[model samples]
Target chain A: MKLLELVALEKRYGERPVLRGVDLAVDEGERVVLVGPSGCGKTTLLRLVAGLDAPDGGEIRLAGEVVSRAGAVIVSPEARGIGMVFQDLALWPHMTARENVAFPLRARGVPRRERDRRVAELLELVGLPDAGDRRPAELSGGQRQRVALARALAAEPRLLLLDEPFTSLDPELADRLRGDLVALQERLGFTLLHVTHDREEARQLATRVVTLHRGHLGEEAR
Target chain B: MSRRLVLGSAVLLLAIAGGLPVVAMLAQAFFAGGRFDPAPLAGLLTDAGTWRLLGSSILLAAAVALAACAAGIPLGVLLARTDLPGRRLLAALFTVPLLLPPWVLAVAWAALAGREGLLAPVVGPGAALALDRFLYGPGGCVLVLGTAFLPVPLLLTMAALAEIDPRLEEAGRLHAGWGTVLVRISLPLALPGLLLAAVLVFLLALGEFTVPGFFRVDVFATRSLERFAAFYDVRGATAAALPLAAAALLVLPLESAFLGRRGAPLPGAGTRRRTVPLGRFRAPALAGVLFVAGVLVALPLSALAARAAAPGAFREALARAGDALPRTIAWSVTGASLLLLGGVLLGLVVGRRELPGWRAVDGLALFLFALPGAVTGIGLVALWNRPATAFLYGTPLVVLLGWFARYAALPLRVTTAHLRGIPPALEEAARLAGASWWLRTRRVTLPLLGRGLFLAWIVGYVFCARDTAIAMLVYPPGRDTLPVRIVTLMANGTPGMVAALCLLATGVVLLPVAVVLPVLAISGREDRR
Candidate 1:
């Protein structure tokens, strides 16, 4: 069964349309990657799915529930149980890596012991075992990405959204992170909707590669 | 809901509380003969005494700005680059004088040079008398205002300095010595911020009435007041204040240009990685800070407190202005809240929207902020003193209107600037985590806005608390604000009693700031930009 559906998704800024007539779907455990050039609204489409923003004229359904339309949220972002790793790695600078990872659990009112245990397990899984106390600023570029990944996975999200999450890292680090993320996704068996401009990353990580052009989702490449 | 709607609300709030009063004042001034004639306003404008008042105001503002820059620049550099002792504490202490009314400093200086003052015995009688004479004129206005305003430049320069890439300074250091590099590179880069701060000081000094009034120095603000409060010449008062408003109107654009949409961001949650050791200059910089604190912060406060320390002086002052004290406190809180409300709305507009219309709103807010307090006060009276609006005019509401009109820009600018730096993802992440809008605001938005909200309150409250020029005109009979009460009581009350009241007012303003600043600094997220 489809875990996510974008039905004729359209978005615009005034008269200029950014994402027009975009249709897409992903199965419950499919690892789908979206590839696009700059300013192709890849991020916008992801934002719409995550309920970060509302589309101008379309509907988004998550797990068979209408979530967002042109100007309304049928289900709020948080209530949708979505987890997103932001393009810039929007880890709260005020929080340590451990706290950043644990915040979603805390927000969900998880007990302190459970939150701490999960946070540590996720950190260790992401290869950031000893960097839990360090702020995002103190961590290296690759480490920050790992911490973000750990955070995205902390809620045990049914679907995970990644938006150019490895863009800022060096090529080697990006490749390594991409491989680890693919392996993790396979192991966890969660549906993945990731946006990236790198064809190699998509080829390596995705079971299906989709392209967006002029706000329209092109035919599936794989 | 819509950006336009939010901005429209802000503009409407400003129009009611601030813009209408000026409109009423202008109408009164221009149509004094009950026609469209500009004869009275024209005559007042071209008059020699009017020109003299304008000249003196310009002169005073220039002198104060110059003095403030002179004091603020080196201190700013010291705080920013050098490993100064207790820099945060010093920065907070620097704003101490500013939290009090300008006139109180004049009162403190008066007490300091009096025959029974602290300095009377140390300094010879002749010297003390000479000092007394000096403290009661334009020199005194510049001295007091310059000291109060020094932090304006210092804070701005520190923020600007932080924004400068330290590598540029280091690159310069490879070629030239630190002093040469500082004068050549760091100083040049920070000039715009320094000048912007100076312009603020200029506008502030130009708009001030209290210091000059206490010193018996005749500037435009004092002239405007005397015409309204003393001689009951509303038209003449309006005429006198028109030039001051014109000055504000002319300068507001420059302020916007210099400060940008964010109204000149200040140093916050700065890292100490870029600091330079002062070496031999350390002692002098520390000594300079000490001297500034002594002259600007410590000395005047000691004198004021000493004068008030006489038995029953403080109590008598409080008893005399009993209702006025609480009334001032209560109105100031209400006024600050109102100001913050308008400020948040306007700030969101200015910070978020890139449209030119928001700039117009910004210009209007800044113009009203810099418009002479007497002008704002008289404008409120003219606008509200009528049968239809008699309820507002007959109570403290008019005074609150004056407060929001003149000072709301402060919080708006501060909050907007802070909001600008906060990424949209910060809230989105929270929202996607299942936090409701209310929960997001309380946890995400409010935490980010932590100190900024409190700082806005302080800015709004300090201005409202010490305000006199506007309060003096708009305050209803049998009701008095603390600043107005203290100034008026100076005539009938003993010197010691007045001094105690000034000290008491300072304490009132400082307590909240003292408690709030450190807590926010420590607890608030390291902005780590």
Candidate 2:
């Protein structure tokens, strides 16, 4: 069975239609990159899959369970075992690096010792061993980016969603982070669905590239 | 007090003033001879007179809210979004009344409508009598209370309008006319705050004792006071207070949610870019703002000034109110100080913890704040009229305590707003750095919230200074706040002298607000730079 499935997904805000009848599917461990023009509903699709929003029509299924359908969520985001790094990173600015990483574990009710151990490992994995003590405001751009990735990976989610997180980074730093992300995916074996406006970055990181034009999805040669 | 003691005591004080009294009254309402019985409450509910009073009260509140929103929302939108001439000056003038006590405004309106009122000579005897009759009933109460409470929505709506990204309007502008864009885009975005303001106005109108009292309107507020002070019926008073409290609780969640979503009263992204051109509307719009100012500010003040100009009348009014003036000022200062101390103690934990249940604290404060002054007075008497608490009940301390309880929420919420704006990452970062909640709050949150706390303090001071309803209910026999004195002297006193006393009360209230305004302006400028 496919790890994720979207069938005839439709959404609108008031009278303005967005994501009209979009359908796609991804197998376990497949890295899918969605490239689209601004306002083409790529982020909306990602948000729906992560259970942040419900669609207006049609259904979304994960692991053969319908998690979302028109106008309601069958499964909540946390219960769906999915993680998302928002376009703005959504790092809890009140939290330090490690606490942001450790938050999912704490929410999952892991004990302090185990939570601390996992947080420390994630920080080292992201090459931010000492940056754990600093807030998102104090951290550099690349460090904050890594902290978001470390946080997404902390709870060992079966699927991870990234929303144009590295768009602000320099090309050199973006390339390095992309390679590191690919390696991390290889080692951990989690499904990745990434949204980007950059064609080169999509080509570099995606196993299957898809173009979203006016809300419809089409396969692109990879 | 230690931080724990301070916090505990502040919460305890909040409980005492906000909860304990209401509980005391409700306890009487729900039980008789120490056995559970809903008979007294049910009696009030079933009474035909009780239903009439409730109906009248609801009608008065609905009329006032509708009237206030009718004026306030449009004014807020025009002032905030349009390039109306003298917009900034008009905005500031409109805001001045929020600091002035409502009864002061009532006194002004009375002066403008009385037998010897501003319009009495101009309109003549028959017309004046007819006007005074309307002004003294539900109609007059609605006009006065609605105008008195106008600033609440005005400030809230302007703040809401300021938050909408200019780009949203710009996007709409491309495909549609400005009118279409405003209706479809800007108005919808500003609707939350406009509605929130209307909700507050409705609650304020319902709880309005002063305007209704001055006008001789027999609404639930007046009825509650009559039940407590006139008939000495504790169960009856509590029974009367029940529905108002229930009304507050009904809307508590929405109020909390709306307030929680916004920052302080003024959140400016930059004033210049948000304004739209008034074009042909400027001259007419300026007339509307001037009319509002005349009705809300100038008429009352000028009436007082004209009244004060009467030979020896001002001094006689002063003599009658004598110590009440000083007492009101002293109690106001002391009350604001107590509220500030308590607010900081309570708010520090609520703001720092960043718990979801913080909304509960906010809702409780607002609910207590929304309770009719008569009910609050009744609650105070029920709780503290005993021999053991007689010392407090005998002094002006009770009135001061009442003020502290009523207005502490204003400051506490302000402090919490400031604390919330301190990014959550700051707390998480501190947590990771091995700092406990206390340490992080002490070292980070408190320092960041200093300005907010100060602003809240100033607001508390002005509100305490101007309050009359609670003071009238809770003040000891010999003591009266300025508001109570001015109100008392209104009956059988010279219209001029009464206006003078009202003006005096207005001055005391505005003093702190005036001092803070320039400082706030300077701070805002400094921030922009």
Candidate 3:
């Protein structure tokens, strides 16, 4: 079943057209990796999908409900039931691992006891149970990556969007995190729409791979 | 043009506008006639009266800074971080006092708390007497100057908060509400800016003369002005100004050593900023903002309005000080234009660190900025009142030069900050495309800086127009700005007439911003599209 759909999406900054009349879809429990060069509208597409930005022209539907259309957002980002791990790994530097992981639950009105249990479970699942009290700044790069991943999954998002989340890590660390991510996805059974510049990364994690070139999506390769 | 030419031009401009005046003043102080003399300088420095005045100035400045920061920080958080209603309007309202001369606030407060003032009817005469007494001393000086300078920390806080990596907030948003995110993420990140604001407020309040002078509080700034304007004692004025200048000079290094690196760009500095929703608390937050605005801005302005409502008050103001308006406009325009030119050139050289001594140049300009307007005016007169420079000194050029000396830092800082926000790659790409330095700066750099330059020009114009201390000291006879005119007329002018003049001066200062900001906003929107 389709979890997310984009119909002829378009975006522009000034006179510079970024995303142009692009159509795409993602299915439940499937990993779709989008490969594109920098500034080719990969992040723009992710932001549009996450409802952080409205398209200049197009419609974004999640779970068959329109979330965004040309120049307007029907559903705000937090209500879109989508979790994004930004390229910068955007962990709140002031919050400890446990607090960061528990944030989504708290936002959704989860009680403190249940929130704590869920946060601890998420931390253990992310292999950082012992690092729960450590802030993002005190954690290692890879540990920080794990914390971000844990935070993203804390709310049990229906669709997870990763915008080159591991790009900053060394190849060795990135490779390990990608492996851990795939295992987590398999265990959690969540739909994934990931963007990357690494073809090897796409090969390792994608159930299906598509290339974005000059604002057009190429045929999917499984 | 070559880099050498650019550096040389900046040096010459700085020397003429800022450096030479200070050097000439110090030279005059240390040399009697043609020979070096230290006795007079030494005697003046050691005077008990001088120390007492300096102590009073320091205490006043410190109190004002603390009070401003205390009020301003929370106000900034509300305006910048929260989803407060009328945030933009509230911000603009709070900024009104900063654009006017600080003494306007003193005048407004006095009118509100005086014997026949607004509060007298409201609180009855007995309590009003106590408030009146409080309004005319050190406490009153702090209240007026603190309110006048509050926008420094408030605006700085907003700017700093705006510069935070929004992604951090967004990540927080995905999990928690805005209240948590602001407390945990946004305010912590913006702490450096808040601290910088406190330091700036302290310096500004210390250097302020008009507010303290109006309240009958004798700080060093007033002493410096009194010695020169009242007694024509150049030596005494120079002696009075030396400690203030030294104090400002010391702060330069401390600011450099402490807060210099705090402004380094955050990772992902240019990302889209997201606003926190006020949600259920919007009405209360808005009411709180309005209350603060009412107390700080509206109440005082309303006093001026009520007083000025008398028949023919504005006409009387125009009749008495009407000529000063045209002179104010011309000088402010000329001063702002010159400041813009000097600012852009200096901003580029210092911001890009193209010269080895850019830090020193930057520090020197900032020290001049922190130096009281009276000090800069004294310096300019000492430098230009010679037979050879009589043509320059006897005209309005001396006044314009004093303005450039004191307030050039506004445009310079604004331009430098704006330049920093533009990525180096834009210019480097032009360079790689075979563009010369001049061509790259014109085509690639300056276009990106258009909004910033416009903003700087407006700020420069307002400061030049509203200046009291420097204009009073250095303006050629019959060439005073509106602020100086108002100060001159205050002694014998009726209360209604004085209030009318203050309102007219405010209108003049606001007219450009009111006309330009909307146009800039529309242009900004068009650019975004």
Candidate 4:
């Protein structure tokens, strides 16, 4: 049931080695939180897994298929069926909340009626049913975060990556969202690979916690 | 009332100097013996020859704009988004053409491709003659003007692309390839700026007269000037210019409708900066950029330099220039200083968006900027040529007014953009300290906006120094700017003298830029440190 695998993945930016011979694997329906200091390559590992970047040296397998190898993306990002919510949410400012959530569905060639239904359903699930017509700029900070999460879930990917999703939120809101995320993941059964600097967020969100320090992984207590 | 008065005065000045003259020219074209008649207007518009000329002009502008975008966009992308080799030097070289006037480019091109050109000895007479023949038509105008204005799209594209949040593209990339992501996300975000650049290039090429005139291309811009000078007929000139004015008027609304007020919002925090990797294409891209820089910019300039290398060329040219050299310097400095002052006032008005009809004022300024110099010239003469207004009409003030009307948009845009980064609270705080408006402006606002105003002044000076049509049309007797003098003297002046004068004029424009850029760079470095 291994959904994603990164075997000795290596990445460097100029002379600086960010991810050196890093190896990790995530099974289906596992909530794996990655904690690291700034510049410790947690985001790099997420990007590599999501196929947004090619590794300098390594092989990445998805469902036992070689998706990337030796600085080449054998499988393109869209074909990888991976969803990522960036730290900033990165919602398209020009799009309404509904359109932002529906983008992935439209991209996947989902029918218009189904896409609308799914978008509405997702908006409702995120507690932003009334915000479908609003732009990212029109939404509150917490509302925008919900929209981003909804967007990431739109395509129904097997693996979902989160990079510091609640880093910008207040403690109360972050705790509330973390609880909601746990419920949603339990219901959906998608593998989660979340990166955050907050230890409490990791402890609360993860079934298993992994620490990435100086381009290597260290397992943490459950 | 004071704020209203301030904004109102600025708008009034624009209306009088820029708007009224154009209206006067249009009125003259459509009226005879104080009666409104469309007969003359219809006659001119219906003329086959007029249409032919306008058609040629449109074709030329379109071709130039198309060529500029075709080259400029790729260059912009490579320079801004890739780790291309020597990109910094290549960018600097490419922008050299923009510093000089279009006519100077035409002159440099002729020196490179004419029968008696630098290439004549190398390529032999027959091929040189063939090249010379090609240089005297629409093809030559497109090459010269396209090269001259290439920086418009180049710089704007870079600016546009720079403003896009990299995360937007990254988000798209998580579900798509770079190509699809670019098309769906990056390009859509950058399209407004790209469109604006293309429109600007088209307007500029359409308004261009000197290069077309030099090449004997007979575009509407030149034809309008020809009509005015040849027959002293304001009506005829206005008829020729109306097409360009109409085109400008049409484009103004379209630009606003498409671009809105948004200028590619600032990139967000934690957005990882990712460049488009040019893995295998790096060398080819660098070669392409360098090839363009060499052919379009370096070659012609080198030819001009060689031709002006005669021992006494500059000395003789300076001697012949007499008071023109000094006069050009004086006029440009005065014009730039005056423009900076006016631009600050107008910038505050437009940027704050507090005054009524500010958008209209802004649109009018842009319209004047886009209006052909010949049209503005014709309009100015019609409005100001009277015994009662002799003081204003007969002196250099008339030319200054024309400069103000023509180049107002430059300073205004600079100040407006600069004003966005400035907080209004500083001025409000000063005012709350019981300081008068003048005191707050002098102490708080002006001091803060100094660098932007300095940049505006330099831009104003560059345009003023190289200005031809406005000065050619409205300059008082014996008060022609150096550009006007060089343009007029190009026909009969010695090769060395003309080349030297071109170099001298270019030098005058670059002098301030050379001084300011390094100072700014040092200041920037200091600030960074």
Candidate 5:
């Protein structure tokens, strides 16, 4: 099944088109990586899919539901059950790992006991169970990325968006995390759309790769 | 290139102007009775009035600080975090009270809340009961001072809030609620900045003279001013000023200690982009913001406008002010120029080289910043009123010196900040190129510091123009500045004329700066955008 689909996406700032005539699709449980140079609409595409932004001209369908459509309807990120890890990790510097992991569940009005149970399981799954009580500031760069991942997965979203999530981490940790991410994705059966400027990171993590150049999506590869 | 030279010259001139009054005053204080008098020192410690004044001043300052913090913190949060409607308009309105002279605010408050004033018409017979009686006492002093100085904390809080990483709030939003986000993340991150702002506001409130004086509240500043103007007792006033100065000294260490702690890092690379929507609260919040702005900007201005429109008020005030306008402007401009010159020279001297006790010198320069204008005036009067120090007193020079001493901090701070931005390599390169010290400074350093110089001059000029406390005490007989003229006219029951003169004075002082500010703002916004 098509987990996510964007048809003829277009975005403009004033007179300048940022993202124009873009179409894409990702299958269930598939890890698709989008690669582009700066200002090439790679991040914009991820943002659109995550529902952080609205498309100027497009229909976005997730799990066979029309989430966003031109001149019709648009779903909020929270309402769409979409999880995103921004380029900055966007981890709450003030929250402990456990608390961060429990956030999305809390937002969904999960009870404290079940929230705690799920949070602990997610932390252990991310290989940071021991660091559950530590704040993001107290964690290493790689640990912070893990916390972000754990937080994103807390709500049990069907699809996940990662925007250069490992850019700030050391190369060795990035490699280790990429392996862990693939293993977790396989186990969880959650589709992923990851955006990165690093070709090596895209090549390593992607089951399918899509190249974006100057606001246009190029040939897709498997 | 010429602009740099003009800016450099202005800075150099203002510094000298700022320093002369303090120098003259200190000379007089030390040389009294042919030596520094111990009698005045004893009088200062033992006087009942002095202690009462000190206690009242401290209490008033504390009250004002708390009030300002309470008002400013929430407003700052609304501005920085929430997508409050008219946030831009509120931000601009918040700064209006800061620019208006304290005397103007006090008079407006008096007109509105005083007996037989505006509120009387609405409140009718039971008006006295409805209004707080203490509004003219220490309580009123605190209220006026707090309202006047609230913008400082508001500005500081906004700056601090802007620096906080928004992702912290998002993290909380994901886990808990907006309340959790505020208490756990926003408050803790903004605490240091808020506290620093509180301390500075407290210091300023403690030193304030005009509000207390107009409201019949007897704080240290008012008492010190009284001693000089009413009795010409310079020694007595100087002695009274000592305790307030000592209190200021105590606060200095505490302020530095708070500032030493690390603040939240500013939003930059790797920081999340998040703007919390105001949601349903948008309309009501915007209304609340607008109401506050209306009360702050409209109340005093309306009262002044009404007074200006009264029969013969505008014509009489303008006629009198017209005679004094040229002299006032000349004194303010000349004094500011001298102050700028001295500040730049001193800044270059202290900032460039690794001189022994440079830190101490910098500390001393900032020391007078804490002293109230009235206290400084009293000290100056004490020092210069002696026969031996007659050369510096009762002259136009005395008035100029008084303005310079009171406002020296402006140019000094500007020049010092500017000097720090210049690269040391440029100077080293100039030296290696065989340029003399004077040549390098004149050609390279002066050009680099042009903007700083212009800013310093403007700051000094505005401060000199608006200042009344020190200028009142030492304006020699017929050489009163605009503020002094307004104050004297108000005290003598010429309310209508005083209001007109104030509007004109404020306009004259603010117009040039106001005209340039938008251009500067546009350029700044363009750069950032």
Candidate 6:
């Protein structure tokens, strides 16, 4: 089954149409990577999928649930059960790695013990068990990415969204993390939609690659 | 063409608003006694009252500055660094005193600490234990002014604290503990800003006149005004003003020494998170915050409320205000409009064009920022209060000129800052696009500066409305601004009247906040750029 589907999604800023009609889909447990140059609506697509922004037209369906419909209902990010790691990481500076991972669980009203247990396991999963007490500011570029990933996975999300997550990390660390992420996804059996400008990263990580050009999405073989 | 016209118009308006009355005042002072006489200088220097007032003023200002620093710094740290409970509410509450005019706070404080005030019922008469005695002397002046001016340092320190890269704290947290993080990283980074804030608060406190006047404490400001208005000793008043002006000038060095190199941006941008969670000591901190807010806002408001409840007092005050309100409005509106116009013109001249003595002109405009209002009033009155200058005195023009001279800095500062932000390349581009200098300014520059001009006008208006010292000395018989009227009512022992009028006056002072807050909110949503 398709885990996520966008039908003729369009967005505009005043007279300028930033995202023209775009259609795309990702299968369940599939690793889909989006590649494009800057300002080619790559981040905009991610934001639309994450429900941070509303599309000017068309529909978005996630897990067979109609998440957005033009001129009708639109689901909020929290309600959509979609997890996102922003390009800038957007990690709450005040929260520790553990607390950040525990946030979605807390928001979903998971009990404190269970939340802590899940957070610890996730921190260990991301190889940052000891770093859980440190805030995002304390961590290195790569460590922060792991904390972000650990946070996104805390709610046991069906689909994970990563936007240029490894862009700020060192190349070696990025490659290592990419391998770890792929292994983690395979082990966890979760679908992933990642956005990056690097073609090499797309080839290395994606099962299927999609290219966004002037807001039009075209499937490309990895 | 339209934009240039608007720019020119705006400048013209500011000039008219700020310049004419100043010219009138100078004319009055210099030509009043058939010629300028330096005789009053000797009399002013010899007067024991003048010396006493100056000493008291300096002491009061120093005390207030210290008190403000003591309260403001800790609160700034707590608000910025900790996940203290109700931090947002506490931040907002702290700004309330800043919005209120000093005279309004003075009147409210008087009602609370006076002999017949709310505490009188609980403490009994002649109770040395009561705050009434403290409220009427040097102690009262410092307390009231300190509380009133605390927001400046609090804001500056908070901004500084927020700018500290959160990563540094996080690194410290990883290596050591929260205590170590705060001591080693946060406090050191925030020190420059805190010292800068202290200097700013001190400078502001030094110029304050209304609070001291309300407390019946003779300060330099009041003494200067008395010399001019009562004794008609123009030279004496001018001489009296020299020291205060010198003290005000002291701020320039302090500002440069402490704050010049520090480039910490305010906390409005780059803040990813809205709330920071508290780990421990939340409840006690919350209680302390609540207690401070209660004392600062609730106590004074309650005193005013009590006085307003008295029989016929509110009505009587309202009736008097009703009689005075139109004239007050006219004076403030006219004065501010003139000041804004003058400031914009002066700012534009200083900003875009290089001319002889332009730096001196700029300095003269900013000079009033440091000088106490009484000193400015004294200087103007001294220069204008002559037999030959009879045309300027006993006329509304003198008041208007004083308002302009005192407040031109607002528009000039705002305009210059705004102008600096608009890249010169834009103007060059317009020129490259076949636009004449006049056309480019009209179509491009003026339109861009609309918001700045509006804001400058609003600030100028608020300053004019809130000022009492300058208005008190220079106001002709027919023109009394709201603050002057409020001060007069307080001086005459009409606490009820004072409270009512002050409340009314404060609304005028805070009008700009109503407009500014919404614009800020909308802007915050639009850009992190």
Give me the candidate number with maximum DockQ: 4
lDDT of 3 by residue, B190-263 (tens): 77677767877887888887787777787777777777878988877786777777777755765564344344
TM-score of chain A of 6: 0.97
The candidate scoring highest on lDDT is 4
lDDT for B104 (candidate 6): 77
- Tell me, by TM-score, which candidate is best: 4
Worst 10 residues of 2 chain A by lDDT: A86-95
For the second chain, the TM-scores of the candidates in order are 0.91, 0.90, 0.93, 0.94, 0.82, 0.80
Tell me how each candidate scores on DockQ against the true complex: 0.01, 0.02, 0.33, 0.44, 0.21, 0.03
Model 5 agreement with the true structure over B223-305: per-residue lDDT tens digits: 66666668876666665565566555654564444334333344433234555667788888888877876766677567666
Q: What is the iRMS for every candidate structure?
A: 20.2, 15.7, 2.3, 1.9, 4.0, 11.7
| Candidate 2 lDDT over residue span B141-232, tens digit each | 88888888888888888877775655444323322345655776577667777777787788888988777877888778777777877898
TM-score for the A chain of candidate 5 = 0.96
For residues A1-222, what per-residue lDDT tens digits would candidate 3 score against the true structure?
899999999988777888889999899999999998887889888888887778999899998999999989888777877788988888766578888888788888899999999999998998988999998778999999898888899899999999998888999999999999999999999999999988999999999999998788988899
Q: After superposition, how far is residue B415 of candidate 5 from its true place, in Å?
A: 9.2
Q: Alpha carbon lDDT of residue B3, candidate 6?
A: 37
DockQ pick, better of 2 and 5 = 5
Q: RMSD per prediction, one decimal?
A: 18.5, 15.5, 5.4, 5.2, 5.8, 10.7
Off by over 4 Å in 3: A1-84, A91-161, A168-193, A206-222, B1-3, B24-53, B250-271, B420-426
Weakest lDDT window of 10 consecutive positions for candidate 1 chain B: B263-272
TM-score between candidate 6 and the true structure? 0.63
**Higher DockQ: candidate 5 or 6?**
5
Q: For each model in turn, which proportion of the native inter-chain contacts is also found?
A: 0.00, 0.00, 0.41, 0.56, 0.24, 0.00
Give one digit per residue, the lDDT tens place, for model 2 in A1-222.
Answer: 599999999988667788889989888999999999888888778878876567999999999999999998788666778877766675654468887788777767789999999999999998899999998779989999999899888889888888898988988998999999999999989999999989989999999999998878876655
Question: lDDT tens digits, residues B186-218, model 4?
Answer: 766778788888888899899998998889878
* Local accuracy by lDDT, each model: 0.79, 0.78, 0.84, 0.85, 0.73, 0.73
Please give, for residues B1-529, the per-residue lDDT of candidate 6 as tens digits: 4534644554444344333334444444334457765455556668787677677777778889899989888888788768887676688788778767786777787677677777777777877346787888888888788888888788878876665655334323322345545665567667767776776677778777677767777777666566667887665555556666666666555544443334332222222322233556788888887898788777987887787677777687778776567777677778778877677766776676534454555656655666677776665565566699779877888777777777887788778767866877988899899997668766887777777877787778778877777787777775676677776666574667677777777777776667676796577467544
**How many steric overlaps are in each model, in order?**
1, 16, 2, 0, 29, 26
Which sections of candidate 6 miss by over 4 Å?
A1-222, B1-53, B78-92, B123-129, B159-193, B257-259, B262-277, B342-363, B386-394, B413-431, B434-454, B515-529
